[model samples]
Target: MDAAPSTSSRVQFRRRNVASRARWVEEAGAGEVVESKGKLWLTTGVTRGSKLCYNVEEIGFLVEKGALILLNDKDEMIGIEAIYEKIAVGKYGCSWDAFQAYKHLKSLGYIVG
Candidate 1:
């Protein structure tokens, strides 16, 4: 793991949709992948094959912490508000309240499953 950056690093993550309710992200696009010096994936997300995939809640938490900046297929920056909107649309157990709890738990130094 690298040292934490002095400022927030703008990472590019492409949306990898497995289903209507499942929203995951991968460090995609051409060129070099932006390094998030902080512990971005150490506690969140899971590895699918060679890629690190983040769910809706995980992505929201990362974006809220300024550890990620998601990008579209066209390489456009997806705003934080847009990210929250996407997270809100998530079904099943993923929701803004759930994300809030996740963020709060992480802030308290507890590792979330």
Candidate 2:
């Protein structure tokens, strides 16, 4: 019989439980500005989801792919690809609008990742 894999060689993933009121940092191109609640929010290229809400914020760095990098307001990198469709549509206008925004940003030579 084949021997089982050794526990020492196994990879472990620790799930982080975000607090209810936790804030996220979103990373976007240096000049990109995201608006919310009449205030200017930076696009960290990161989005996050919760049982009751979704949050978007600014990020100081960039990530690969179109994945949004989420961070806390303190500038600490936290999560990625956390933005969901429903929340994105609601917050960033509609699906079509969001797509347009993505394209516009990309055309400006800013990395969307």
Candidate 3:
């Protein structure tokens, strides 16, 4: 498998707060270019209108994989630690543990939904 890229190669995204959910919107280049390079959407998120939106877990997974560089509304960069804080932790929630499990399974060649 191809290892995640370094910080320099990460794709940039701006966090977009929509109602109760926070969506990460790709901030650089065309969506097609990013999709071709990252196989984006195939792994996470959906295209809404002209923007590519990613769920919280998808943001965490992409960032952890060194495939994303998330930005705040102010255009400041966000780190993985900060991103982790946003992931909810509770029974029946999209918790960090679940994300870890998802990542592990994907690493093992499992096709996670």
Candidate 1, after superposition: displacement of residue 99 in Å? Answer: 0.8
Number of the predicted model whose TM-score against the real structure is largest: 1
What are the Cα lDDT values of the candidates? 0.58, 0.34, 0.55
The TM-score that candidate 2 achieves is 0.25
Q: Which structure is stronger by TM-score: 1 or 3?
A: 1
lDDT of 2: 0.34
Which candidate ranks first by lDDT, i.e. highest? 1
lDDT of 1 by residue, 6-106 (tens): 97434434343311122234342111223434455577666666656666666666665556666665667667787777667655247788888987787
Worst 10 residues of 1 by lDDT: 16-25
> Model 3, 100: alpha-carbon shift in Å?
1.5
TM-score order of candidates, best first? 1, 3, 2
Candidate 3 lowest-lDDT run of ten: 28-37
> Each model's RMSD to truth, in Å?
11.3, 13.4, 10.4
Instruction: Give all TM-scores, in the order shown.
Output: 0.63, 0.25, 0.57
Angstrom error at residue 81, model 1 = 1.0
- With a 3 Å backbone cut-off (N, CA, C), the pairs that clash in candidate 3 are none
